[model samples]
Target: MFCKAFRVKSHTALKSSDRKKLRGDISSTFPSLTTEKLAELMPPKEDLTIAKVFVHKGDAVSIYVHNRNPIIFELARNFYPTVYTLWRHPDLLPVFTTWPPVFERMSGGADLMLPGILMSSFGLPEVQQGTLCAITLVGNRAPVAIGVATMSTKDMLASGMKGKGFNILHTYKDQLWAYGDESCPPNIPPEEIEVAPSANLEEGYLDSESPAYITELENLHLEEVSATVQQESGEIKLSTETFQEEKAEIPYVENCNTSLQETMDDLLHQCFFHALKYKVKKSDLPLLTSAFLRNFLFACCPEGQQVDIKKSSYKKLSKFLQAMQQRNILQVKELSKGVESIVEIQWKHPDVISFVAPETVLPLETCETSDGGRKQPYQPPEILSLYGINAKMLPLFQASGHRKGDLLTANDVRSVIITYVKTNELVHSDNKNFVTVDPVICDCLLNASEKHDLLLLKWDDLVTRCLERMQPSHRVAFPGSSPVVRKGNIEAIDISVAQRGSNKKVTIIKNLELYGLDPVSVGSLLQQRVQASFSCTVLPGTKDRVQVQIQGNQVSQTGKLLLEHFKIPRKYINGLDLAGKAGKKK
Candidate 1:
């Protein structure tokens, strides 16, 4: 089962001799399979060199076709050796039939009950007690579960179809099924069959063409049948046809429109009601507001959609809960002036009880796109050779076997320092956190002011000084593009203060695209964080580069937001010094 851990005991390559023996075993186990069919399923000898056979501790043997694609898993110790993939293959559907309601349960590792079986007019297939059989859903002929029959068809009929009929070994979505490529069972239309006979008839009795005699015999059996038998098997008989009819009768609910034409209030309301009726449980009521929203409300959101309170019409979870309370859908309890918790839920509210959640189509964010296409995968920013090691920083790299003028990335600089300290035994013996600095290190790496402070320095300070010394030699080198010709140039984020009118000042930020952030989202988030008016405007000279302009002196707040939240490096942000100087000027 996927819910539990499955451990693989050993993995080995099958030798030529081993392959020959395995083929013999397979042939004997599956007599119906032809040599050509086996070859088509498995790779050739050349590809077999990379193939690995994994033996799981549970006595399951998995053979990977070309070391990557898991083709088959066999139960070596079963009486009639079982292969899990046979159920998945379309060519092997005539084996069995299972009820549709138990499909989800069987996939989740439940045994198949006799009542879940859909007996044809001819009755259950004749098989031995331990014979391996494939179990398929009612409407779909393709097998979705694999199991061994627990009792013979005759024994099952004598005892009545009430107990566990099959001991399921493996099913769809189980751990073994997840080994190979991800796949779903193929869809097949249900086959129509005559109603099952009321009384047990001899095998081949249904094949007889004497319609008048068969009808007369059926009427006599129905008259002799007791009410107890009808009462006992009534539900099982109805489940076969009534369940499917009910599902077919339910109308398909259309997906709600999430485009800009739909207001945020309407979208939130639709999603909230859907979550209340379908997702939230009565057992989880009387929960803290924060926990309820984070665990229940947010988790109930459709895939690819994120819940942001700021995006809601109410702009806060508390306000939204209050509105729901007013509508008699929920009741909230306040712990303090601003803190609240959900106390009770009106589960039977007319709007919630009757609402049917529709299938999710597109996320709200993607619905606003002009083309209505799914959002593309995120591509990380291009790697750049920002700096070359100078003479002052040469020894640090030289100690780590790198020469002067060698291009060093941010990661390389940290590695060189760590290597030099470990090699020179410069770390303080008592406290490994502190590194002992010598004159050679001080002259080349440390600042003139920091040198006099102490010979001993923290690990962070040493790294900071090393980077500051190497900053002057910075050069931009975009990966997958032309090499850098010019040196000592680095892309810096532009931040500036402007006098709008009178005494008011606006802080403008640009070059955010270089860090791979959408300008619109950044502007909206900034507006919410600072409680200030913010707008995104396309810069004049650039193609699509936009700048975020927030009201008032928000330069410092903008810097902190970028550094703490977006994780942009501090060195890249320019004009932060102007924020403090402007304050001082006033």
Candidate 2:
């Protein structure tokens, strides 16, 4: 069961009688479970709750302790009675052991494959198919995953221990584990766990299985099954067939520098023409420049290929679109500064009208490989010395016991202001929002008029002016990457579309508060402008600010509304370049 969805379902507290019945059920499911052990583990009282949760393809009721940690549960149709038993206590249940690598795979939502299982020296667990089993790692002996056996032990041996052996229900480190307090598996050394000699009988058995082994085994199996065909076939035919299949599936480009440039050019050309002919429609014209580039043009690039504008002959997407306009293929117009929108298109442009896409066009390959072999190691950005702090601002730092030559970071400046405010008891008694600015703070931070008169300043304004006075220092050390420097007093706005249930798109607009805009008012305006459903959801960890979400791909309409109606500057909206284009109706 995925833990995230389980947490979302409505949980109701179990009644006293119901809790008693549940205790009885658990004892019946696990016969060895004693009354004393059950009392310690599953307490009868104290707010026990149950929620019907969807587990994989089936429904299961999750029993939670104090509506927090999900300890035990049973799937639909009883599912072999309590399909999973959690390891919240230190007791050995019927556990099947595997290697550490397999434990990692199971944690990542992968089923336990037969090949990943490590049989005990004595024999595999004598369990029937669909039996609930605990999967423990070889070294740790601590159960990491719980699931139902897909095959009986006899059936597993008969089939050579191949295919999926366990259908994992819940695993450690999964979403469910994240819901409760962060609890980790106990650390048990390999020497502590007992194993029979037969466990060590298979050579290299303990070593993690590789993808190459699966491929080799498949080829060997194929050869054995079709011995006659293999004898008749030449090595050239087999090799060529394999190469052709690989090429058809994976578009590989030559690694040579010269070929790289040419290949990129061809790939861009292919993507441009393909998008223009198939993806873009005349009805969808008057599209926002950001929306067109992000959703249509950029999305057209072959999967796995990095869409770098520098690699193309044109250095910018706008320049490339302008080139297309010059060729009479389309037309572009500047609506505002740095904001361009497509105004016209030549539906019957000669080149586009007669174009026929190649049946087997190879996609452009990326510089890095799937195995991350050619990837470059991460290099931290260079730290450069900033300009030294001004002498006039020295008192602000000095008042806080900071020496004249003491180096101050952006955080240090804020700290000094906070310390000064708290020490002087400047905060208003009734309303803490107001800070009574003293003559010392006024002289060092505020303007001349403000210093002349005693004034009540907002806490945020005090912090902002404090940061503004400190100049960048010349001496530099690589303590860490410098904080992001805001270009202006106004914060940048961002608009992005996220996929929701069943591929439905929701466009999210953030940082409206930065522009002194009310999220509720903006949300209302969006609904009116687009004539679509929209809502204002409060952003987490923020006081009153919220994010505006509009249903479907509404970036084009949202940008137009912001620019023409809202009068928001083009530069302030940061992620318009990532706005999605509206999909063509079928």
Candidate 3:
């Protein structure tokens, strides 16, 4: 039977007596059981047969087929212990040593059995079993952050297994409930959006809004004119503020350019898109205080430190870059690869700078055997693997030294690796070559296979290109951290504004639909409209325009006097139509 989406209560806590009974049942199954050997205890082979599969979603990441053991999930909770086990095993140190073991396995089409869970606490989310759904976590690359999706489930019921293998393939035809952190609009499930993880993921199997339907929304150029308004005096005014985020005009620094630049750009773009969802503005960016075209040049020597490209600053950023270049690799090499170290990242973005310093890092590469490939196997990460079950043996065959160790299934490996690559430095650094677009001019050069107006990037190209870029770096360095960002909820506003002096009305803010408004830009954001409107809920058709009054000096001057003079009439407009047109602009 295939899996079916079901909404069980998050608080499915077992009673004290019931918990005791499960514990007792466990001891009966394996009489020699102790807390140490908990993970090592597998259920009866018969119990694991294809009776049914119940996968959980809505945590940091979605669990496609968490069928290994109910207790394994119970113990692992929301944290993913499997990764650490495969990355570096202590007693089984001879097995494998590396970060993000899952990416490798997924790429190779292998599956992660219960025996391979990692326990080294990397803040890898616990494979949680909550009620909400998650975005799909397939095809990610060395993903630092886990993404969840609402299921392809029509409804939340265990009874509706469509048929066979993983139930993710079966579509519910309708959204179950909103999945993920974003409060998906009511009635619309998060899964309904079909988050095509990264630019590389292929289009999903589920049917969704057609090209024309989506294009119609984009072409409207809704964001261009935040809103339109008509005054009581029959005067018209439109004024919409635009936040022009300067694109990265930096030259590719040849081999000197690390995926680091791409990483920074993709990350910033995430911040941009996320902010736009809340209406964050360009002026708010801390670094872009230098916005003039004349001031937009890249300064490798931002502080004129005259970086030797050889020196190691106290900063982790320096160590990270230097490691990629070999200087720090020599340093990390000098230290016993056995001793794990924590690297704290102090990165500065266009906006406020933040810190990401993970507490534990297993030196998998350093924990090598002297005989090159002759090391014993199974060195699991510390966070996973109870009962000393070495995660390495999950592999169908012994790992060839020429290959990376088994951390996750091949598909898992691919998803984690590719998503990381896309979200990191792969696409953004060479966006001009791979992605050519001029939003203002309405020009694009996309060579997607599909013939919809704009080229849609499919999974294969997105992943392959990302992998192609990573192939070079994978040869040079170990895996890097996966920093993640997601869009939050959006708010509604009844913004209104008008202009000053005579009759030049503010058209930008007049009767417009703002789909993605950055949250940070609203406090002092100027919107002068003759009249503005706000909708309780964005419904299709009918009164697309909400109502509002004039604001600022213009409200009294232009808003009031213009209608009296011109005898003009007020008119309402369909803002949604504008949004679609702009998105599909040729």
Predicted model with the maximum TM-score: 1
TM-scores for every candidate against the unseen true structure: 0.36, 0.35, 0.15
Where in model 2 is the C-alpha error above 4 Å? 55-60, 77-85, 88-92, 188-204, 207-586
Tens-place lDDT digits, model 1, residues 1-586? 3323243322334578766766677667666667886665554553332212232334444444332345545545322322334533544423567544455556555677665665666667787788778776554555667778888888878766766678876666555555433345545444555656634332211211123433564555533432221123222222323333444553211111243223446656766787677767787766778767644555455534444565456888888888889999999998568778777889899988887766762222111111211243223343354557788777667767777777777787888888888888899998989999987688887666888887798899888888778744444333333444346655678889888888899888887766655564455455545556665565778755777778887777678667755556787889887765444522
lDDT scores of the candidates, listed in order: 0.59, 0.58, 0.25
Which candidate would rank higher by TM-score, 1 or 2? 1
Q: After superposition, which runs of candidate 1 have C-alpha atoms over 4 Å from their true positions?
A: 1-13, 43-69, 76-94, 187-586
Model 3 score (lDDT): 0.25
Which TM-score value belongs to model 3? 0.15
- TM-score: which is higher, 1 or 3? 1
Q: Report the Cα lDDT for candidate 1.
A: 0.59
